[model samples]
Target chain A: MSAPKALRQPASLRLVSAAFLAFWCLIAAFPIFWIAVMSIKVPIDAFAANPLDVILGPLTKAQGDGLSLLGIVAWIGFLWLTFRVCTRLLPALVSRHAPFGSAALGWLIAALAAGVLFVLLGFGVLVPLVRALDGALGLEPLIGLTTQHYQAVWVENAFWRNFVNSMIVTGGVVTVSLTVGTLAGYGLARSGSNLAFWILIVALVFRALPHSVLVAGYLPVFINSAEILRPILGDAAPTLYGQPLAVIAVLVAINQPFTIWMLRSFFQNIPADLDEAARVDGCTHFQAFRWVIMPVMWPGVITTGLFSFLLAYNDFLVTSLLLDASNQTMVPAIASYFNRETTTTDQVEAVAAAVSITAPLFLLVMVFQRQIVSGLTAGAVKG
Target chain B: MKFKTFAAFVAPSMFMMFLFIAAPLVSVFLQSFYLTQPVRVATEIETCTPGFTGQVCKTETKFLPQLDENGKVITETTFVGLESYRNVVQPDHAWAAISSFDWRGLMNIDFWKALRFTLTFTLLTLPLVIGVGLALALAVNNAARSIRGPVIFISLLPFIITPVIGALSIRWLFVGDGILTRLMEAYSGQDIAMFAQAWTIELLMLFYRVWHVAPFAFVIFYAGLQTVNTDSLEAAVIDGATRFERLRYVIVPHLMPLIVFVALIHLMDAYRVFEEVVGFRSQAHVISLQWLTYDFLEPDDAGNRSISRASASAMLTMIGIVILLVPLLRKTWRDHKGAH
Candidate 1:
């Protein structure tokens, strides 16, 4: 097509477009907005009677329509400001004292925020919707909040135990998935042809199975394994049946495929000549991978690893079915607290559990704010 | 040395995959076929008669013989043909659906409604996600460093965060008494039950879905945007093309491959639509095929009748979606192939 005349624009137009895009982004990121606000509101103020009225500007209960829209805007602005202040200071803290420059802390915080943001999404959104039906027809939340839901959940060694269960499950899956997916991806990158195509199809299909079926199919096998596995390391053998290991096993099995597919795409981006150069320099292929290829693929590996770690940690169905009641993860605990009869005080804790689950993750996102936005979509645009 | 070198490079991951993945999947498929066999009975029937049914059988008719008082044979139950599969296929025949009262859920109205609700939900959500995703990709891809990192990070945070928190926090935000509704009531001057109203719920669901996936959309498009031929873009810019013209004739046409790639991934994930809907839907039966599969697997007396029907429904949804998107995927991929 031939060039068209340019529209004359002042520099302000570009600035306006930037502002408009930022505004749309804030709207799209509603939970993140709710999160920073909820974090600081002091729980009592968060749920005080007539709680919605407290928002600034047009959001006073006196004016409802413009109130909500402005409330949303105000909420977004509030959260962005917090992020700005936090971001500005964090690098300073790290740079000023290099000794505390712990890289893993960023990952931990991101995971925590992931847990927090998710819980807020569910309770702030799902349970209330269910309860609203009750309210609309003159009813109450299905499981209203209570101090007891938190108490019941907290007092139960089971609930705390499940958090450990999830960690083990997520950790096992991540380790196994990365080990296998990375290798398989490397294999595919070097393979001659069509098997790679078939494998990619397999990777995608497994990535897409409803875990309900996967877990259901697993139940009987696990239940029946007591007799056969008793001999392996004796009756005390870390049985796969109902263990957190079972949950992680399925997760590793299910999730490994996708990263294999993703890493394959990025692995291809690594030049073949790098391996040749390493060989010419007299490094064995093993040395080449350890010294060269693996390091080159580290960023891809790290991104893929982080994604898989989050997926495993966030998963509900696999962990729930294979795990016993005492073994429930954060998702199931959050679901159970609401689904079971909960009182209002318990409701806050349920929301608390939700926030606590993803809080560290949000912190991670703040740290990696640079890499995530860049590579987050990398697989999609190319793969 | 080179061949051994290549072999060495690939060993660890390959060994791990075989032991963990291929082993389990093959083993599970084999196991799904075998029901838990009762080589030895847990308890034999106590006495002179056959069986009663439902609540009556195990409680009231407990002591009857393998043959009931009526002498109808009762105690033993064993392997049946894709009996579970058959249940979902001919759901009417299986006992009333196990999930609802009185078996009425078998011909699940809630299931179908959820399916329909999901359709409308996806229709509303996808555009917002894709639109916002692409817009961010275009705008940020052109911006300075000051605005880029933070904007894209927050934009993409929803995608990277674990779904447990991500999904729930989102649900909480728009809940009926949620911050969103409370704000809506204050702003609108009329109390709107954000989750209680159908249109409002639809809007809320769409809004959350967009927020949840918009990051993915932005990330994918941004990734593609990185690969764009800047020289090609500069040539168009130098030629005096308008911004819209550049987007249309230059950027969009150029990003066709990425667009198709984004659309395919979104279409696949969107139709699955479980985590988002599960977070949002509790009141009205919002029908979607994924939820229907979930409903099918809810609970049955003997075992869940899932394999065929759940797979069947999923397969059907996939087929339907593919049929719809095939032309687009093909047209876009084909057009963009040689150029990329």
Candidate 2:
């Protein structure tokens, strides 16, 4: 509203808003934080003990099984050194920007104070209590941290195969969808025809269809095609039943409608004069698209490509139904980890696998947060 | 552009759309009317044994695959008409339940149980998602500049997580000896098993849906907020309008289109809920139409799949989507005509 007077809301309202935002922020981030922590913890610590206790508890004698007293001392000394460096160096860096940066200095001091509290809690209270309890009750180590679960999932579980399958499928989908969708979207945007309009409408309708519905239709066709081809192809014919190509084809088809719509809007934003200008320069429509429009449309193409990759990468229904056991992608592979046959230890490994799959996506989102946010809003707001 | 050039450009997408999308739809419709299985026939096998008096002969009836003269196993596909659909809807059973005044009997039917939950899940979460999302948009819009970026990123994390992972995360929190379960038990001084009951699981699923989808609505609403007419807002403020009055009068009307857009998308997505049922392992308690189709496709003890029933269920799901989409389609058609 640009009302300067309205900006000066009461302090109470501002405080309430801040508190509310903080509460929701915790709710949004805590599960991920919890999973990250659980992923690194030893299996016993992960499943046997409460998560809060594991985070807050000190190292018991059993937890210190592989460690020497000297190691503990070194850890304490390292923490102290880190605390001193942050307290001394951070304030100096802050004061250069503002002459009176007392708030910055206060924040630095508060952070250091929290570090001191954690050290005291870890060593003085938690360690002694755990050691005493262990000595009295002969209790085993209840909490310990290790990266072994990640290693096990990577090596013993052959997760690399699933990761590669996901990459191949996603790569195939992104390339195929972008290429075909761009052509179609450009056509629909530049050519004002009844046929193009009808095609766009049909694409919209198809886009609304659920993935399971499509999968249901594909099952019979794939099975029948495999049988029909068996006499000619011999032993290789059955590959169609669980082949990655079949899954990729379906993924591209399902994703094409959305991709086309997104690209159409993007293409529409580029003025038609550009195409006319190129035509006047003796270039055909395809030539104009390849040489002139594409460069200008690169950002939109990339955004659409990212969305396509997400569709293929994140899909479960098609991949699970189409791909056999050995060919399962990461989502379905991780799903297979959850069953009645698995024990608590396996559950820990499953959680670790979940973390493994999510970490890369988290990093990707962090890197492309702006693009993803814009792409998501582009459809709804424009419509 | 000429029609030839346009066709050349769009041919690939058109071919794919026809092959995979349009054809599959037609195939699904046709498949709903046909049932395929191995052909079986009764055959007689004779056994003779030498006895003290004479040779005793016995004939036994056995079921065998029907074979032609070429010795190839015969498979039969027959026109089922509306039989598969009848099996799914169970109209006779539904009538019995209704006439006998047995509401529980209706719930016992898989189709109705799944339908009741699916509708409840979709319709109930609509208002909650929109309300929470709009509230979040308003809050984040007012948040300090330095903090807004991080807040938005954190809020979007829930939505960004894969649907299965998101559902599982919530399930883990409430499952036996999980953190939230432990906390609740500790706080109330009583043992509570969240997954042991139907209502709790349904409640958690509803909560999860809101948590996972509100970010989408928030993003749309936030974008809409940026386009609000400043002149009108200023005029309202000058007329001594309070914050709530200004919001209701100016901002709400401005965001109405975006609200409808989000609602349409959400309805389409929520209608075919599947991942949550699988992720929560709630098949024992709750199911959806999509899951019902998948269930029908699962092989039984004899390794025979109910493809006919699955096709019927898939068709039913599409019908539901088409019904929900009719209003939106009508509006779109009207807009198209007006623009022309």
Write model 1 residue lDDT over B1-340, tens digit each, in one string.
3345334534554454455555544554443333433233234443344547533333233333344567544433344545434433455543455444544454344444555666666566667777877887877865776777667666766776656566567666665556766777778888666556566656655666677787777777777777778677678878977777877987777677766666666666666666655565454535456656555545457554443344444444545555655575466447545444
lDDT of 1 by residue, A254-329 (tens): 7767777778878888998998899899986557666778866765776777778778877765665566676677
DockQ of each: 0.28, 0.57
Local accuracy of candidate 2 as per-residue lDDT tens digits, A14-123 = 78888888888888888777877666665555543366654533332245542234344545675566445443544445445433423323433444454556558655
RMSD of 1: 10.3
Q: Model 1, which residues run further than 4 Å from truth?
A: A1-16, A35-44, A48-160, A228-239, A281-283, A381-383, B1-86, B89-124, B142-144, B186-191, B197-200, B226-241, B281-284, B291-340
Tell me the TM-score that candidate 1 gets on chain A alone: 0.69
- Give model 2's TM-score versus the native structure: 0.86
Which candidate ranks first by lDDT, i.e. highest?
2
- Which segments of candidate 2 are over 4 A away from where they belong? A1-3, A56-143, A229-239, B44-60, B66-73
